[model samples]
Target chain A: MARLSSENLETAYEIIARYPVKKSALIPLLHLAQEQDGWVTDVAMAHIAELVEVTPAEVIGTCTFYEMFKRKPVGKYVVNICTNISCQLLGGEELLHHAEQKLAIKAGATTADGLFTIEDVECIAACTEAPCLQVNYRYFHKITHGEFDSLIDDLKAGTRDEIPAHGTLAKVRQHIPAARRAGAVAPTDRAEPVWLIRNRQEGAS
Target chain B: MTMNDVPKIITSRFDQGDAHTLDGYRRTHGYEGLAAALEKTPQQVADEVKAASLLGRGGAGFPAGIKWTLAPANVWPRYLVVNGDESEPGTYKDRMLLERDPHQLIEGVLIACYAVGCGQAFLYIRGEMAHAQERMAAALNEAYAAGFVGKNILGTDFSVDVVLHWGAGAYIVGEETALIESLEGNRGMPRLKPPFFPAAKGLYMQPTIVNNVETLSNLPWIIRNGVDEWNKLGAETSKGTRVFAVSGHVNNPGVFEVEFGVTTFRDIIFDPKFAGGIRGGKALKAFIPGGASAPWFYEEHLDLPLEKVAIDRAGSMLGSGAIVVMDEDTDMVKAALRLVRFFARESCGKCTPCREGTTWMEKIMQRILDGHGRPEDVALLMDTADNISVDFMWPPRMTTICPLGQSATTPIASAVMRFKDEFERYVGGPIELNVTVKGAAFIGPPTRKKEGSGV
Candidate 1:
């Protein structure tokens, strides 16, 4: 029952224009769909399929393969805590338990109030600052139980201005001027570089 | 031991707060390398890099210069893909470079694009790194405004466009071929080689050169200072410095840029300048020489140098330059499980051996930690690991299409080989240990299809 807004449709068209091939924008459009609707609805996938000139089944194939795109609806803030080796060594497992208790939800469940979703994720590549977690993909490194509680409280109170909703990748949207584009096209009349020809000749001799 | 000072070439501006901006980057000898490179032909620029002998920093330390040449001659519209997908469990240096100093990366991209004759370049960053994506996107916009990227770069005859693409989370996309698949809006599964080598047949089935972020980041310095000056450091094989991210149990757990082939593991882990030794005066039990994929090295191998040949000869690779140290109190069985679980979860399900073998390994490791371990679980785990990796050897001979499948076995082989007693200690019954699998709801025993009730 979800659809991209007129503004988002324009944005999507602009994004597709950036790529040499239309199909290459499928992943980015899926992200845009998620951004517009929180989770990718069936309608949005079919819409994206139409946009990219691929079947809905093909869209599903690419969407399901990636871990970031949520197939089902999640809460506003998706708290992904790392429990891989580095974080595990630094009390990451205990931290997950603490988060579970605080949110009143298990690892893969959404809270009853629809405010938080907890996930025991793989490494977010912030190993140095072990025991790291991300709220809607914004990093809080080397977090403690107290710091985590305050973060939850802030998110619940809607006071954390920096952390946006789920699927919002960045604050700034990229806008490329048409003149600045690389104009990438399959070459038919390109000439061989002088250096390569020289190398080939030198080898022949 | 050569105790020469490790020069900070790529990361010289890391401490500067505003280095991500165009004006700030210009002040710090930033675009000077591009200017120096612009003075020469693309081939001459590539020749300079070959002379410097820069090795790729993304796990496999292949020569970056040689990789650029592998793209067939006159393969028009050959692409340059800059791999910012630093997803290896313990690695995080690329994130720092992307977040703190993006223009330096952009300059590196420009130099590479010009050298390789690519009309378009793709910078693929992993999705989990939101900050990195934002910083890079903003930096790319700044770069385009400054005429550093896009058509007619810097008022010269040369023109190229650099596109900043963020990947949806998939670890296998770190593989070059798989990355290309992901770029093409397909599942991030690796293609079979021989026909799909990125250099020969890549994006849109044209020749392509894929370089790591750190590898390309070295180009500016190499171009600006010349090869002889850049070659002053490092050893016979690895000819430059590398950023080693040290984490776990270490006092100063962070990224450090050190000259390659000079410092040893002992110096990196225990030295005051690096990780500053294990925390709380704890003794070192084991350490992953590279990221989670590399086999664990023990106390005996601490004296081995950080050289590629030295580490390779020592039966583990310095893959991804991520060093994770485990102290004496750390439970080896639990540690092994954590790594195997990562590989299993991120398997991508392209290869059956990888998809099933990693899961099998994880289940066994989980069972061992959960007080339900069978006596034959250790051998069973080893056999499963061997089936995936083909053997318990360094430079692993893999059964799957990519090294990811082989990566699952390193922890198993290393843990069982050295810490067999620890794994054995967890066997036979409900052993109450602090290392219990907390999130058991996610990974439980597979359900048996009730006594052959054919539906």
Candidate 2:
């Protein structure tokens, strides 16, 4: 197990302090541990248990409970494909097959080169873009078999930029076109009927 | 396309632009409810809420008024928690509200705090939703700056402060008690029920009211619209509109709102205006009425009214209203395997049943999918799921832990029950999976690519 530096430990403590209850820091602490060591280990779990004043069993229970936490070492990039109802109906199975065939490994298995691991995730909450995959926590939406293959090729060629660490909001904005962001009117904007819109204009008082 | 596209109830006020921003919200009578709420006594506010009969929109259909009344009276520093950790697989309604109309949620939080004598409130959001957290925090800052939140709210003696706390993104955090624990900086595992209900001993051991994001978001409207008016929109028992996240094989796969009893699955899915049924004339196989955790239904159940009671009566839940449809080509075994795999992976492992039970279920499903199933495995899977305990007792039941164990069994149980033939077919031979390409022939060998090898 990799030893977490004092800085990471302090950051964990700081995150716990921010919450009203120390236990709520379990997920954040695990994240911190992973951020520092790339994966959680038994030694780190023990240390987290001691720091949080919980039993080692409790820490282990938490680490194993959530799917996001890695019990074993993972590849540099994780591809989580959504095969839930929405995605499945939209040809998610084909996409998954394509992904497995392209990577030459089944879902939940890492590639031989240690570059990627593919996982079949449940709904990723991005059902709008059916057949989506989260490549290393960054979402790739509206994926097709051909598009996925090309994406892999781009990644292999180093043309696709490395996903930035702290630019998720920017990434989301980038995903949504500028026109949609600026001109996409919400439901509230047209609350009244069209007659009302015309009446208000005609009867400006 | 416009308000015309949205049903009247859940989105009566949706078309009002900038409803998230203070000025935009106020122009559409947003905080007017707060003023109305403050004018009356707390008991009166509670009574009005009780009269409205609003149920929690975050999966559990518990009444909001009942939750408020359950809180201990005269407790100092009582807490109001907004369960914004929308981790349910099919659910994304809370995320939409938080990201698009945060102030509405904040206003609802304020009203809820006022009704329950809560001075401090926390919005526990899912951590993976960095954008939502940022949007909510920005809204909180705007509300605080405008004196809508924090010390002497709206120039009244009654004060409330709202803070945004992010969950590490676990589905269990959506459970109220677990949500309380997560808010307190602990692991987001759920505690035993009965003694640990959030109302009695919650959030640093103070009386707390943990309401779903949509539930809280409804308070301001309920107060402003009056209970009588609110009751007019929906059925007698389940009053008000619900935001349904319609995804799956539908044409218009987005969030839609409808009155409680008015919208049926047929109207929501087949209507040209709404979801527009399965895309490209694909035959519907089944649909998950709620999130992935909820039990699934076959095509025959399409006519089942998409209501809380009706769906529950059909042995499924209206959980998070994340309608996930499946078409004819969908593989039930693989789908069930994928769903169970998520629960297994996310099982917080607090109790043996959930941790081990989920793992066992996943393994069995995987075995079946991999064409390595024995006949006994089917009965064994059912027995294992049935024997799995739901109670998480002190010293750690090792056998039980909240409903995580029970919830994990749902997809498997439902899939086996509904699609028994599919599972049986895999046992006889090497399953020759079929793939149909719309405009192309069978592709060549699958492409092999390594991650981080530059595309």
Candidate 3:
């Protein structure tokens, strides 16, 4: 519902510079928007469309095509469990069921308190570590029921809260020189990159 | 010679100490190939690769050497697009290479760029591979800082820039043109062929050469090892070793590098050295010889050699060199559903057949697996698959814009064709939706409560 704060807009321009064409930055910008909000909100998509000079429909098209971009709001952590052939063969389905029961919700549901959202994702290419799952895109390999239970406990206690919210890319915000030039990228069009020092609260779910 | 006797080639540094680091890579015959390639003309480099007969390690198994050779002269500023969208269900080899030994891929990129006279290259890594992306991005930065990727690499007139792009998560993007589309920041939909073929016209409507991560990763070895040495390996027509991402119902499910025709599905799935036979001594039921794109191979085909010619002759593919094995306890109907679900979700809505056909098959599979089916459902699935590609006619025949139609159809057609009894059992039975079946548990819903859906 809210637009990216002023500081993130500066980061947007810099990301665009990384590509020869600004449109190529769409996926990255969507990632940036996600970092701002827990999911890619409709307003955020519109804002991204303006930034990349594409129609909102085009943004929606690309965004919907991707399974990672959540159009609707999700919990603080999105637990994506790969249930593909490899995962299925080696306890991936059972893991999903376990998570569902553990969280008191089904495969695609978020907890009532909005702390976690469980997803039965496809193969993440980590077949060797069969019962693997990712929390906010960070992999947990060879996971077991006990490990998952402990992880959930850590998440609840905020001990495993080192990772930022579901939408955030990295816990730290970087203010670097522009790729094309040396000048510090000022907040553009009055939008700015949410600096770590200022927006520490934003990363909190 | 046995598989172990063959040169390690690209996968040698897999387990070495700190292999991910640049220093670790350089110490172990890493970029020597780039240095060697820098001394030769682009044409000479292309000729050497062609002579070596290095086929594309991606799904197509096309000649990697000839791909570079096919870059048309009329199009200035040719581009090299590396397919790193390793989303095919069983394939994860590229993820390992990108995360562990990305410098090798970079050196190969530099060589391929030099050989193809291209000044720009883009590695479109899968969105799900966040760690692989981080490693590759870090590796690219190191390569640039070290003067390997930027202007006048190794102090020559040649200058090339590499842009490391990320896909949002479209399996279809692995299909070169769709990759180009996603790289351009559009919905990753496959473009119609003839005019849209990548070599002749691609990426901003310019000539381009798209190679797989493994295909380009092999370049450094080809340039350094010499063509004759490369040719001596592998069966005729297909040269060089490929990294097979073996998973599912095996003792040691992991990535293995092997020469073409040197081994068989039986060896990879059953040999102690490879997958080490199906897990818990379970009887091997079926396997996907390639990634999801290839057809299913049954017990009768276990001895079939893992090669392009052999696989093609058996009516399947060596696609992406991903072999996912299954055991007797697995449900064939549910397995087909898993693959169809993937295809349906990843269809991209670009073509009529792929977009609609995959979804239709998914619905039917869900119904059948949920204990609501008729005898005609099996025939209907095969019939629909036939309409989708009808044996994957090449040169833009009966297929859709890309091979995705065939990819969507392959598993279903092959599964129903090989194991009709399984489908029949599910069909004529009562609607007993067993949510307890571990591997097949995620097949359908009512599995999820409506309002509780996070998205």
Residue B324 shift from truth in candidate 2, angstroms = 1.7
Question: Positional deviation of B158 in candidate 1, in angstroms?
Answer: 0.8
TM-score for every candidate vs. truth? 0.93, 0.77, 0.88
- Per-model interface RMSD values are 2.6, 13.8, 10.6
Query: How big is the positional error of residue B197 in model 3, measured in Å on the Cα after superposition?
Result: 0.8
What residue runs in model 1 are displaced by over 4 Å at the alpha carbon?
A187-205, B1-4, B429-455
lDDT of 1 by residue, B1-455 (tens): 25545678988999998999998999999899998987787878899998888999998999989998898875676888889889998998999999999999999988987787776788998888888888988998988888888877787767776777889898889999999999989999999997899999998888888899999999998999899988988988988888999999999998988888888888889999889999999999889989989877777667777888877765778989999999999999899999999999999888999999999999999998998888688778877887877656557776888989889888877777667678768895322222112111111121422311111
Instruction: Give the per-residue lDDT of model 3 (tens digit) for A96-146.
Output: 999998999998889999999999898788887788999988889889999
Model 3 stretches with alpha carbons more than 4 Å out: A5-7, A169-205, B391-397, B429-455
Q: Which candidate tops DockQ?
A: 1
Task: Name the candidate that leads on TM-score.
Answer: 1
lDDT scores of the candidates, listed in order: 0.85, 0.70, 0.77
Clashing pairs in 1: none
The positional error of residue B36 in candidate 2, measured at the CA in angstroms, is 2.7
In model 3, state the lDDT of residue B445.
26
A1-205 per-residue lDDT for model 1 (tens digits): 4777898999999888777778888888998999988888899999999999999999999999998999998999999999999999999999999999998889999998888999999989999999999998899999999999999998889899998899898776667778776565543426553334554476579
Q: Which regions in candidate 2 have their CA more than 4 angstroms from the true location? A: A1-79, A93-120, A135-139, A145-163, A166-205, B1-20, B389-399, B429-455
Query: Rank order by lDDT, top first?
Result: 1, 3, 2
What tens-digit string does per-residue lDDT give for candidate 3 at B316-416? Answer: 67888888888899888888898889888878887888888999999989999998877777667766766786543321135677877768776676566
